[model samples]
Target: MKILFATSEAHPLIKTGGLADVSGSLPSALAHYKHKVRLVLPAYRAVMERLPEKSLKQVAKLSVGGCGREFEAVIWQLKAGAVPGVDVPVWLVDIPALFDRPGNPYLAEDGADWWDNGERFGVFSKVVAELAMDRAGLQWQPDVVHVNDWQTGLVSALLSVETQRPKTVFTVHNMAYPGNFPHSLFAQLQLPESLWNLDGVEFWGHFSMLKAGLICSDWVTTVSPTYAKEICYPEYAYGFEGVLQKRAAEGRLIGILNGIDEHIWNPEVDELIHSRYSAEKGRVAGKQRNKAFLIEELALLNGLSETRIQGHLADWLQAPLIGFVGRLVEQKGIDLVLEVLPELIEQTPANFVFVGSGHKSFENALRDLAQRYPERMWVYIGYSETLAHQVEAGADMFLMPSRFEPCGLNQMYSLAYGTPPIVHHTGGLADTVVNATDENMLAGTATGFVFYDPSRFALKSTLLHALGLFAKKRSWQKLQKTGMQQAFGWKASAQRYLALYVED
Candidate 1:
């Protein structure tokens, strides 16, 4: 099958969140299965810097939204060697006016999202839709146009306008971030007024790219099975429950758990960390070395004494190194984690390492907590790919107490690296992490801990439970082996996606 993946971000080039990871990994996974896959992403400044000079090929100029604004798009062919036998062609939509700039792709200097995000992504979607219709002129055509999140949601909307359209698959990585714009901006999108209706792009009197994709796409899928069910409820729906429920009633909505790229996550082969270890040979010693290295690094960075560092590691090692790697925002349950920290520290000798940046209030709170308990806590206020891998591999336990996780990759990575995850039983977390129970004799099959409620008490109690189990070396080792053995590969996911594309 010839597949075209339209996304706002892709990894190893430009990334902001999990969407980029998916966009980068999934196509490569599909290509490995011998499917002809092509990816389209905006050529941001970062992408330009990273791309090889020769890989870029000049593609035709694209005119979007009837705005008479032409942008020159370059096609960068990602060969088998580029992604290791994942022969996928990656086309970058280069338009300096919209995508070319400094800093993060989504945020401005003041940390506010670019106000023109709606228009920016809308233009990219229109270009993709246009490209799909022109087979003879283009390098490759698509049987399936897979659009990710709200950024490329408008592609499905645009496809609906054409009679000869390819099968469309819309994957909702997260529904919280709908591409909504004022009703007046409809004219700027150059969409027909007929599309701005209850059954079309209209969402609460606003033009919603997400709504349009949900309504018009051939199939709708979320990241995980539990998330698929959760989105149909009022609390988790983010105002789209009715639409999702309606789609499910029509048998068009489904869920497929996401998989991480194991090639990039293998601890034994990864060069980014201080030490390397495999689950079979070096699990214990490698983890100890990693713990020591982390402690030394943190102490050096923060100018703490050797005694302070030793105390921190002792606390960290007594139970297990429970780690959190993500944005420090309310959605991630940072506030809940903070509220439960003191109780957790008192109940268990677990050390905490947080690596991420978001929300000024949350960042300050984490910083203050790190200062107060420097011996038991470490915080890094930035995103680092290498550091994230170290956290996944080195930590005995990974924490993702998110209020909602559309399709978390870190949890999967943790499983791969023999680090059991303790996550809130919601969305993708519930779908992926099997809650340990006596009935299941979960010792050898358990991957991580899970809590039901999104509260401080629930989180703290769950951590305590995990710490108790960690005290038992045999049980903990069994849990680690079970997690490492679990398969969350993309082959099954890709097959499910192929089925969705073929569905009527």
Candidate 2:
């Protein structure tokens, strides 16, 4: 099947969150299965900066919207052989007025999303719809036009208006970020009012890109099975639960858990960390060296004594390194983690390392904890890809105490790196991390720890239990090995998507 994935961000070229990773990885995975998978993304300034001079291939110049202005779209093709056998073609839609002027793709230096974001991505969606209509003279028409998040959500709606339509699949990475604009922007989008009705684009007297995709797409999918179910409820829905519930009633809404690219996450091959290790040969010694290096790095940054180093290492090994790597936002339960920090430090000997930036309150709280407990806590107040790898490698346990997780890649990456995760029982966290119990036995299939309640006490108690279990080196090793051995690749996910594309 020929598939066209329309997303706002993709990895290696551009990234902000897990969406980029999926945008970059999934297409390549599908391409490996011999599916002609192509990606369409905005050619923002950052994207142009990263593109090689030779990679730019001019496709065509076309007029969009009623403004009658012609925009030049140069296609930047990212071939599969760049990443070993993974060959997928990435098409960059370059329109300077819409995308070139940017600090971040979505935000300005003032830390606000561009006011014209609705117009910008609306043009992108229109471009993608035209590409699908003509197939750009390719041998095959796209079997599925998979749209991600709200940025490209209008692609489904635009395709719905087309005469030659491909089956559309809309994947909501997060429901919180609804792409809403005034109804007046509808005309600027070149869309007719026929689409602005209860069963169409209208959302609470506003035009919502997400709502258009959800209502018009043939199938609606979220990142995880648990998140798919949660978004149909009032609490997690973010005001779109009614629409999702209606879709569910009509049997159009579905869920498929996300998987990570294990090739990039393999500890044995990754060169960013202090030591390289795998589950088979260098598990114990490699982990010990990694822990020692982490302690040394933390000590150098915060001034810790040798005694503190020994204590930290002993604690890390005695318990487990429950790691947290993501934005410090309320959705991630950063506040809950803060509330439990003092008690967690007192009760558990686990070493914690947090790597992310967001929410001033959580950042300040984490920094304060690092200052107070310099030995046990290490906090990096920004995103770092290299440091993230080290955390996945050095830590024995990965922590994702999120209130709602769409489809967390860090936990998947941690598991791939032989680190068992302890996550909140919500969304993708609930789908991926299974609770350690006698009935499941885990024997050789356990990946991580999971907790149900979204409270400080529950999080603290779960951490304690994970740490207590870590003292049993045999069980800990077994869990780590099990997690490492499990396959969470994109092949199955791609096949599931293929089925969704062909679904009538």
Candidate 3:
């Protein structure tokens, strides 16, 4: 199968969120299974800096029309090693005028969305459609054109007009960002007139790129099975319930769980952590050393192993070190953590470390809390690749109390690193983490802790339950090993996608 994977972002090139992680790993997984994959994305300034011009071979030069203007763009493909894990061909659509700036790809420096984002992604989607239709003079066509998120949603819309086009698969990473613009801009971008109706791209007097993909594509999929079902209702659909409900009724909607790249996330081989360990060997001692290292690094006082030796030390060193890593937004249930932390810190022996940046109020509140209890709490307001890996490797338990998640990769990463995550039972969190109830624990099937309900009370009580289980060393180790043994790799998910491509 020749799969053209189109996304607005891909890891190691450009990233704003989990969409990049999926775009980066899934294609490499497919290629590993003997499928031909050509990963395509816009050539942002950051992307250009990573791939030297000398290494990129210009494949074609063509005129792309969008945004009520005609522009000249070149298509470039690397000779080899386009992605790190697998050698898949990378095709970059280079239009310097639109994508040559720095900072966030879709936002200006002021943190506001770029005024021209509609035009920026609009033009990129046009180029992708051309490639999919074999009109770019590349002499290569895809059997399946898989587009991700609203950024490239227009590709499915643009391809809807062609009779002899490849099958289109549109994936919704998150329903919150719909890529909506004023209806006036729809005419300015020169989209097909046929797409102006409600059944197409039009939505409540706006041009919805997401709706375009949902209605135009041959199939639609979300990140997890629960999320796939959630979007058919008003709560998660974000005003697309009618459209998605129709797709679901027709059996064209699905939920496929996302996978983490084991090559980068596996604790035994990761280079970013302080020490390496696996479930079968040295995990207890390894986690102790890494936790002590993290305690010293973050300037947190307690929980450090005093002996600094290879084997386990006194029982005091086994105190819980909790970790949280993600955007500090209300949707992530950061407020719940904030509400519960003051009491949790005063009452329990656990120490917490947070590494992420988002929402000024949340950041300021976290900083103040950290200052109040410098030893018990530490907050780093920005993201660090090394620190992210360290937290997963070192923390006794990870916290991810998201209000809702389409499909989360961090929980999977935590499981792989032997850190049992305590997550809210919703979306992918529910699909992945098996609650450590008595039944599951007795059967040796429990991996992590799960809490239902969307309140601080639920999260705090769940944390307490997890802490109780953490006190029992043998039971905790069994839970960790169970999570470590689970398979959350991309190969199986990629195979599921391949099955979709070959259907009918």
Candidate 4:
């Protein structure tokens, strides 16, 4: 089957989250099974810069725009060979006025969303829909059109109107950000006026492009099985639970857990870390060396003036090396971390390191806390790809106290690197990490630590519990081995997607 994988971002070329990783890797995984998969993304300035000039070949000039002013979309082709053995074709939709801006694709320099996003992505989606219809001035049409997140959600809706259109699949990576726009955009989006009703694309008083996918697509999916069930509730759905609930009733709503690129994430081959090891050999010592490097780099051995710092130097030295990597935003439960950091410090002398930055208030608070307890707490503001790899390989316990995670790649990466994760019981975090309780440990089914409630006390208690288990070296290694042995790779996930695509 020929599948057109449409997304707003893709790995290596452009990325803001796990969506890019999926878009980049899954196509290649599908190609390995003899399915022709074409991955498509907008030719944002960053994407063009990331690819070599020789790799891009102009395919066609798609006509797209709104308000009677047609824009020429110079479609270019490149092959993404990062996934090995199978090279997947990557289609770049080039429209300078819409995609040539500088910073992140979705945000401006001042960190506000682009005012013209609805129009920008609408044109992109229309062109993609046309391509699915074999109308992009190209000879090929996909057997199935797979769209991801709200950014490409309207492609399903746009394809629905045609008499003979490819089967459409839209995967909701996150339900919180509904692609909603003022009803005033009905004409500007060039959408048919008839689609403005509640049963079509309307949500409350706005036009929700994302809902159009849920209501119109042949099948709808989310990142994880747990998240798929979560979105049916009013809390996680953000306002579209009814639409998802209706789809669920029809047996069209489904969930598939995400997978990571093991080749890039494996500790043995990753050169970013201070030391490398495989699950079968030198896992313990290798991780300890990397942890020492991280400790020195983050200055975790300094500032002993505080009595709390000097009291547990031995425990802090041999204690659970906890790490957090992601945006310091409320959704990630960074707020919960800030609330319980003091109590957690007082409760246990476990070493902690945080990487990634978000929201000025969280950054400021984390920086202050790190300053106060240099021995126990350390933080690196902003994201570094190399540092992320090092942290995953080095840390003994990874932290993902997210309020909701559609699907997280870090926890999977950590497991592959023999690092157990401590996560909240929500979304993909709940799906991937099996809590290492006494009973689960005895049953040999435990992988990591899990806490249900997103409260400060709950997180603090979980950390202490993990620390107690960490002191027992054999139990800690058992949990690490269990997590490392689980396979969360693209091959399995791609096969499931293949079944979905070719099914009647």
Candidate 5:
């Protein structure tokens, strides 16, 4: 089958989150199965700069119409994987006026959303629709067009009106940001007037791109089985509960769990960490060396006072090293981590390292708390890809206390790296991480620590439990090896998607 994967961002060229990771990995997985797949995304300035002059080949030049004007764009193709055997063909929609920006694809320099995002993505979607309809002069058409998130939502709606069009699949990564605009902007974009009613893109006097995707597409999917069910209720749906409920009733809604890119995340051949080790060999000593190097590399103990600094390096290496990597925000439950860290630090010998950036309040609070317990805590305010890999490989335990997650990749990364994760029981976290209850532990099926309640007390209690277990060498290694042996690769996921595409 020929498939067109349309997304707003992809890894290596550009990335802001897990969407890029999926966009880059899934297409390669599909191509490995001998299916022709072309991944499409907008050509932001950063993306253009990331590509080599030799790699990009201009495929077509066309005039795209949107927001009351004719915008010129060029379609260019490039191969998108650094690994030897995995190469994905990528198409870039290059429109200077709309996509030639420096920092974020959707944000301005002052941290506000770009004012013309409605027109920008609408024009991009127009180009995508043309390509899917075989009108872009490429002489190649896909049997299926898979669109993701609100950025490419309009493609499904645009293709719905055509008498001869490919099947459309719209996957929602998150339900919080629903690309909504004023009703007046709909006329400005010159969209078909027939689509302005309740059954189409209309949502309570606004033009909603997300609604169009959900209502117009033939099939709808989300990241995980649990999130698929969560979005049908008022708490997680954000306002589209009725639409998803209907889609579910008609058997058009699916919940496919996401898989990680094993090529990039595996510990055996990864070049970023201090020592490379597999779950089968040198797992213990290799982790010890990496943890010691990471602690020294980040100066995790430099903040300690004279008396605290006197501990031997071997002692610090023996203590548990906990890791947190992701945005510091309320949704990630960073506030809960902050609330309980003081008590944890005062009562235990465990050390902590936080890596990532987000809301100002959360950043400031993390900084202040690190200052109070310089010996026990270390913090990095921004993201570093190398540091992320090191944390996954070096830390004895990883923390991902999200209040809700569509599908999380870091916990999977942690599992693959032999680091058991401590997570809240929600969304993909519930689907992926089996709790370390006595029954599961006896069965040798426990992979991580899971807390049921969404509060600081639960997190603290869970952390203490994990710390206690860490002292039991036999039990802890059982959990680590069990997690490492699980399969979280994309081959099975791609097959499931192929089934969706060819099914009657």
Candidate 6:
């Protein structure tokens, strides 16, 4: 099958979140299965810097319309070596004026979203839709045009007019970040006035790109089955539950879990960590060495491994190390973590390491906590690729108490690295992590800790429960081994997508 993978972000070039990881890895997974794929996204300045000048060859020059203005798009081409035995073609829509100077693809240096984002990604979707229609001077047309998230949601909307067009699969990575614009944008964006009705792009009074895609696409899917079900409820839908329910009634809505690229995330061969180990051998020692290394690197007191607070260490490491790696935002339950910080430090005997940056209030709170307990807590404000891999490889327990997640990659990555994730019971977190309840443990199906209720007290108690279990070395190791053995690779997801791509 020939697939046109369209999105605003992709890994190894540009990534703001998990959507990029999916866009980057899934096509490679498909190519590995012998399906040809062409990945297309805007050529932001960061992408240009990452690619060799010689590798980016100009393919076509065309005029794209958006924001009542015409922008000249210079499409650059590259043969990406993303999968073995496959040199996937990448179409980079280059409009330097829009994509050249950026702190983030969607935000300014001050962290406010770029005022022209609507116009920016608007042009991106137009180009992708044209390519799907074989009107962009590209001879190759896709059998399936798979668009991701709200950034490219307009691609499906733009393609709705074509009678001889390829089928489209629009995926909602996170329904939370809907691309909504003022009703005035309809005229400014030069969109047809007919799109303002209830069944069209207009939602209430705003132009909703995600709604447009959901309505226009041949099929719609979210990241996980639970998330697919969750979005049908008003609390989780963010005002689109009715439309989603209608799609479900028509049997056009589906769910497929996202997968991690094991080639990069594998602990056994990853060069980003201090020590390499597989589940079969050296996992215990590897974790020990990594915990020690992390302690030293964070400038935390290196005596946690020696300061016998409890009788459970047995001459080995003392307190267990817990980790948090994600954006420091309210949606991530950072507010909940803030409420439990003191309890976690003073009450529980676990050391903490945090690696991410977001929401200045959360950042300030975390900084204060680190200062208050320099030895027991560490905070790295910015994210580092190497450090993220190291944290997953090193941390004894990974904490992801999100209020809701579509399909989080960190929990999957944690499982791969033998770090048991204590997550909120919602979305993909519930689907992946088999809670360490007595029933599951006896059945030999327990993997990680799970807590209900998006509250501080709930997260606090769950952490305490996990810490209690940490004393039992045999049980903890069994839990880690079970998590490590669980697979979240792309083969199954790719197969599901292929099935969708080939379906009548």
Candidate 2, residues 400-435, lDDT tens digits: the string is: 888888888888888778788888988988877767
Give the count of colliding residue pairs in each prediction: 1, 3, 0, 0, 0, 0
Question: Model 1 — TM-score against the truth?
Answer: 0.94
Q: Candidate 6 — which pairs collide?
A: none
List candidate 1 segments past 4 Å from native.
66-87, 306-319
Off by over 4 Å in 5: 80-86, 300-312
Clashing pairs in 4: none
Query: In lDDT terms, how accurate is model 6?
Result: 0.86
Candidates 5 and 6 compared: the better one by lDDT is 5
| Model 4 misplaced stretches (Cα beyond 4 Å) | 82-86, 300-316
Tens-place lDDT digits, model 6, residues 399-465:
9999999989999999999999999999999899999998988887899999999988889889998
What is the Å distance of residue 376 in model 1 from its true position? 1.1
Clashing pairs in 5: none
Cα TM-score per model: 0.94, 0.94, 0.96, 0.95, 0.97, 0.95
lDDT of model 5, residue 215: 93
Summarize candidate 4's per-residue lDDT along 1-504 as a digit string, tens digits. Answer: 899999998777778888888887788788889988898889999878867788789988878766557888889988666324226888889999999998898998889999889888888898898889888778999999999888888888888888888999999988888899988775776787767788888889888888988888999999999999999999999988899999999999999988888778888888889998988899999988888777666663344444554465446558678899999899999999888888778777677889998999999998898888777788899888888998898788898999999888888998998888889998899889888877999999899999999998899889889889888999989988888899999888888999999876
Residue 297 error, candidate 2, Å: 2.5
Q: In candidate 4, residue 136 scores what lDDT?
A: 74
What value does the lDDT take at residue 285 in candidate 5?
87
Between prediction 3 and prediction 6, the one with superior lDDT is: 3
lDDT of 1 by residue, 254-355 (tens): 999988777788778878777888878888788778877766776556668877667656545554677899999988999999998977767667788899
Instruction: For residues 57-156, write the lDDT of model 3, one tens digit per residue.
Output: 9999889887668988899896547445436788989999999998778887788898899999989999999999999899999999999988899999
